[model samples]
Target chain A: MGLGKTDKQILAVILAAALALLAFQYFSGHRSQELVLEISRPGAERLRMPVSSLPQGEQGRWHVEGAAGGVYLSYWPDQGVHVDRATCPDQACVKMGFINKAGQSIVCVPNEIIIRLIALEDPAGQGEEELDGVLK
Target chain B: MTAIKGFRGVTKTYMKKAAFVFLCVALSGGLISCGGAERAKVPSFSSTRFLMDTVVTIRLQVIPGNQAGRLGAVAGGGQPAAVPAQEELEQLVLAAFNRMEEIAAKTNRHDPGQGSDLQRLAAQAGDGSWLEVSRDTLFIQEEVERLEQEAAAVLPAAAGLVDTSLGKLIDLWMGVRETKVLPRQEEIEAALALSGMEYIERDWAGGKMRLTLAGMGLDYGAVAKGYAVEEAGRILAQAGPAVYGIIDAGGNIKTIGQKPDGSPWQIGLTDPLKTKELLASIELAPGQVAATSGDYQRYEDIEGRRYHHILSPGEGWPVWYSHSVTAISSGGLKADYYSTLLFLLPAQDALELAESIPDLEAIWVTASGELFATSGIEDYIKWQDKSGYKLRD
Candidate 1:
């Protein structure tokens, strides 16, 4: 009734598989917030807006006039909001469009405008419409 | 003598097992920790079309472990093996483009019900039916002409007679019906057909709202790259145990499996203005896709104005908002397309659209280097300091 070759081999295979699965789960569990962008300017005003207050499903927006431009910032669930519009001939901020998701961005080079996408805390119990802009 | 031989053999066997067990237990901890270090494998392939003229390079990694047990070795349909996964990916993209062309034809083609003959005569004067009309695009055009004629006849007289509201509504309806810009895509059409919803109606499935007619045309160009990555991931996963792979189709990427030391896959985000530099670095785990689109990636300077390649379907021009946008999600295709679409839409509008899809997550970067992200985006993002981009959310 001693352990046989076949039994030992089976045990080895099973052990290997279990170890692999455990590793997979461990890796899956450890998550890091992807830093989509960083905004650093000398004297630019920063505005904080909720993801809900912004466009429901969109990420970011820019309003640029002749010499000024403002950018609205938000996240998927939070719809992080900001204003970076100023009057400038470049009006480059308006042309850049929205940057809602991580690793995406909208920059107004002329007005020194910068808006980025980043991770945020979820506001629970938010309506779908309010959260739509952040989500999209 | 026989008993002694048996005893010696047993002792040797037990010693071997003990050593193996010891080795297994010792390695278990490392193996467990190493599981998360999934590095993207760059499959060797050639470039096809460039994203904004920047050459799109593709790399595919095949999974070597359990994935093989699940998705490899079995051919679903009759396809050739000489075709690299990258080529397959390329084909998928081309197919989508072709589909778009088809939808465009359907939208602009003349419809006979629109009084084609008379409409053409009015527009062409005495040219008769000899106008340079594409046979494939005739029906829809005809329909548009008929609608236009009818609208013209009614609008002149009703310009001031009826309530402005009724007249405006009619004009809007006629305009849409006459000049159809939104083309029907296979995925959207398929989703609608499955849900039995009208173009204007919306329903929720897979935690995302299915809009019948999103008004925005569908192009898999953004999402298809991710889809190709996903397909490559499927192939790698089926390879065998200890198999690790990464699929990077253009900028869209998917990685599933740990590296030798068990670290997450690191991806560099490109700076819009400086193509040679990395704006930021992102780490991704297995079963995830990442995509980035930047205005600097493809742009044509016209009269000193820089125009990027990411164009809005209805606007017929590049979007004006953020310089770049990137989205990471479980599905490669979803992440790829969402990033591109996100760049064109308003911030709030993009978020709403993303929110409609349950599995989709996103992060946005503005022109001034400000950052924002969806709530779920935190689950997958890994940021690096010294990178000018900052997260908003």
Candidate 2:
């Protein structure tokens, strides 16, 4: 039963592959290999898109309709997400500039919209299914 | 004999099982301990907005220990639902800023298109007419009157320290900052004469504040912004005790609660003379505020000597007793009023005055490069420049 050399080789290869995947995840800073964009209107979720799937991160405006009104948002990979335009009287949201960091968001109260960048690598905010209530 | 050999072989397999279980236990135990550190990791959320004629930066955090095992519930119905705790904290801060906007709209004095209630009060004061304003304006006026009476009762020698009666003096000095032209001495003297509260009347029952002196103006510079900060704190306090953060409104700051790890909030004091330098710092527990008044910011050079904004009613000239004074109190408005009042007093008198008031402490930077503080201030203040003398008593 202990004589098979092929079994030993197979086990070693599997262990090496698992360790390599973990190392890549740690160094690259994203377990999922891509970033997810979570969009919500004030309190509720509106849409979620992968950063690469939406559009090329050119300096351009994107609009997403909400319950209150249309929320004008823009994304630049270099700068992050900001409110380009909105229906609100005070342009405070527009003035907030871009929020690119994980768990950071641009909240437009007038339009009741929140745009947050979720990094799978950021365990404090890891889960995409729900706004994490449990921190650990 | 064969059975005995089989048992030995089985014992060797059991030993392997025991070793593997011990290694698994060690690795998972390490993971749990590391994850415990992350639980203490309460992320800080900061937002900056230009409001009230200055940049207002608000930093807020949620105490993880307050979650009480309930983490994902939305704040309430009138607001959005299904919000995370971190976003909920940010939303609460934004709501506070919105309240500040209402305050700014009511108090703005420079807007000519649609005058704020404060501007209207001034216009009515000029024409000898009954001035009606909002409750917020009335509240500010009441606080000014109370402080005015307090100063007169305690420090008669420093009478007219701030000159609540000289609304005209405030306006004249404001012109100096904006236009960089010093007002003629005779004009300032005339305003200083009428700047006595003996000339004005307040009808608390009727919600009216009237000025009897003709050609006089009204300014709420000493206490307006701090009062707004206190009001904003009240808005957040209604949310819950879990709102732990700092609201730095220019130099005046109000801290809501302890930090994430339950440590007191530590604030760095900005150097009055040196730009981008910290002269000292102090720790503040929850529900405390610190307000620093420095004569360095608004000043004009006349010949060689510099003239600052805080002017004396008795001499109708800039007060040069101290470079800066920071006051600590429960409410921001109180701290702000005391800082301005202390800045006008001589350094020695300022320390004595701070000691007399209950729950009030002050740290003063004297004109002669000395740092002095009330007996209570020494316990909390972390002095950066020990070169300056400290009046520990």
Candidate 3:
């Protein structure tokens, strides 16, 4: 038997509701992921916090005790993260300047510490492919 | 009229049944799509640490049900096994880092207090005594010798390009990096004289090494990090075939397996001139390594002349034939060794040498901002920035 006007309307309403649910799932899944800063030191627990949680400007300065000595770190919304002071001889971490992008890191070999920037979610499924690593 | 009414009633019941089934199907499809998104959230673990005087990062994704057979074979001891848990992967990463740290300590030439084997051997230089060293040290020295012989066979001028015995020359350059002063001719000559493979005596059977000259020394700065990275990759590969990961030790990049999607890992080659930008991107398959030697990494400007840390044993000064040389080979040690060797040679000779070698490809950014790459790597390289550099045919 052919479907009547009322039957057709009922089917359309069901289909529309399903599509709306699917759309909601898709859009919510595609929301922009947060950027996180990961601070890791040898023989110590790693600390991970969202970049937005960090205080901006001079008030954002802080220090962490590393294997060698104390390493000072500062964060600015515009500049990202920077190693203001480090007791390591090379000062390589300090010289690394501000690292803001995902996968960028500052390493202090003498202090056995590493500070890296990472995204909370994988960006691989996005249109642009994220690099696994950079060879300098 | 009664018959028509009966048919309508049946039709209406059938329509309601059809509608319920369609609704169930649509809702289930939505649920399945959500399930897929949840499944895509694979367990990923990464660890970054300071080792070998550089930052080493190991990132791994534990994919389940991909290579279950291989994982069971390696980790399950003949039992039907599932994929490794998150904690096990973390342990594997830690193990890799521990191996790297051991290699770093053993090959360190700077401080004797670290109990470095290289330093101990250097202290006993010219004593005419065979000093037993760790197997790692012996392996590195022997590899250097083999690389030297292979390079010499291909191009006589390329011989001694990667001299691990250039400890004195490197020391002088380190001082120059700090003081930013060009060393006198006499001082350079003295360092060059003390630097040569002939001064390095080896007892392969006994796993012993020594330097014949009193002031001579052995340094593994070129090979140590690569060796460590190679070993780390080996450890990861042993864990399971399903474990896909990348170990990047300050540009000495080694991949354990392909990405979760079975695609190759992409590595960005940094621009030497720009320093902050990428010159190109290269795809690296499993078991392949990419290493780069650039004047931008460690250098000093003296009177407008830039002297990098990569010193030439023959010239006793930094080579300027290329701004940066990136070498890709099957093994990390080979890649590391070749990048430095090619950087020390003229651009043409470097390209020729790289072409002659099997399974080795090189890209050279010349001192004049011209780019050249081996034929095999042309397809793999995706140029990112061409504003300042011109690619030569």
Candidate 4:
């Protein structure tokens, strides 16, 4: 059986449309979205802001009043977030360096503060599932 | 013949149109599914608080749709039950945290003024009087006693590895952390002499317990966090199967149930050498818990030697056999106890013991960065980073 020229054109158009739709979905689903830093303290409102909102440079730091004392957090757009200083005795949070990946957190036990990174979109597309918990 | 040819041409045109419609339907269906997948994420509620001297995070996935019938079954009444709203979920997490706080208060031994069960027991030591305490305290003491006896029957040397009566020894070392000065040999010996489960007496029926030795004290530091985590897990479990959650008190993790998709939860293991990097990841079955004991968490350097918090009951000093040990068990207490126990033991003994125990798996990272895991754990563990560690065959 032979098909007319118009029929071949119709088939070609349909195939192209399907391929375009697939390509759009693929790129849109995997595109990286803005990351947010979530700082939570007991008996206080959670502070969430995009990574880009942080000021860049040595002076770009935020102080969070915690249960024990306060913690100073500095951010770098490229290097992620880290605790510059903390009043807690252990200073474990300060020792936990920059954490930019989703599900990673810096916890100050005495201060009762948790700083975590969260992605605005699906983390599964990054080829890793968000960890439920970490055993240290 | 012309009429037949014309009819065939019409049929061919109709077939092409049908193919075009089918392709459009398929394309739209694919897009719709992609949209659905984006919106199919289970609603999650998470809360983090400081409890048991550690950061505890509880995250739960609320089952989709109205669960009135299931709630009625759980409530044991025919009346239609209220949907588990966001506020109810928050309350549920709060309840779990409150229960952990109760356990923490009952087991605290630091402050005598707190009048905690352990503190009261310590103050009444050697008085020849039984002091009443909370049920939580009694249960913890009983479990410690049972574990000690069980370990003695098999491995006598490992019996005192997790002694809760090491309060004096712990206090002595804790002082070292402050002063950065090593305790004299005689001082360590005296503290060790006062540390043993045998010095403690329990009147289980009357809910009373006592320390037979003067100056003897009870420190639930080894087991309290895990016990509190277990208690929190229990509360979450009672919320019914409609909710799957995780209770992470510090690094002691107790998962309530599987994820909404029925896949096992993935728990990351932190490298002791590199505090920030992940050593590996393991898939945990529902209702399972994993705990790790390592020197990296709390340690002090004195005279160029590092002394950690996990003191040996015999030497009354830190054990340096392994860098860290992670244990997986069905209950949080067992996981916590085993992680410490395995850390204290030599690597070979730890692996052997872990294999012998049912429903228990362990991974040991030695000071040299060598990894040894139980046979059962090999199937579940996926090594994430092995740059500095060697996995033994």
- CAPRI-wise, candidate 3 is incorrect
Stretches of candidate 1 exceeding 4 Å from the true structure: A1-136, B1-220, B379-390
What TM-score does each prediction get for chain A alone?
A: 0.37, 0.57, 0.64, 0.63
Question: All candidates' lDDT scores?
Answer: 0.43, 0.63, 0.76, 0.74
Least well predicted 10-residue stretch by lDDT in candidate 3 chain B = B33-42
Q: Residue-wise lDDT of candidate 3 within B1-393, one digit each (tens)?
A: 995566455666785776566666666633543234433334456655666656566767665565555555665677654566767777888898889999989998875488688888888889889888889998988898898788879999988889998888899988987787889989999988887788887787898888888888888988888888888888877667666777767668888765556667766677788754567767788889998889987889889889998888888988898999999998888899999999999999888888999879999999999987999998878775457789786
- Report the Cα interface RMSD of each model, rounded to 1 decimal: 16.5, 15.2, 10.1, 9.8
Model 1 TM-score is 0.38
Off by over 4 Å in 3: A1-128, B1-43, B66-82
Q: List where candidate 2 sits over 4 angstroms from the true fold.
A: A1-136, B1-45, B65-91, B386-393
**Model 1, span A78-129: residue lDDT tens:** 3333343445566565466556565556665654545555543332212111
lDDT of 1: 0.43
Q: What are the per-model numbers of colliding residue pairs? A: 139, 1, 0, 0
Local error of candidate 2 at residue B4 (angstroms): 42
* lDDT digits (tens) for residues B1-393 of candidate 4: 995466356656686776666566556634544234433333455555655657566766565544534544465566544445555666777898889889988998774478998888888899899998988998988887776676567667677789899999999988887898889999999998887888888888999888999888999888888888888888887666666777766569888854656567876676677655567768899899898899887789777777999988888889999989988888888888888888999888778777877778998889877987999988778665457888887
Worst 10 residues of 1 chain B by lDDT: B158-167
- What tens-digit string does per-residue lDDT give for candidate 4 at A24-105? 7666655444355666666332444445434343444545557887687777655789988999888999999999887789
Which tens-of-lDDT digit does each residue in A1-136 have in candidate 2? 2414664465455456546654554454433223545655432212334353332232234445444465566666556777777777777778888877767787777666667876532221122211111000
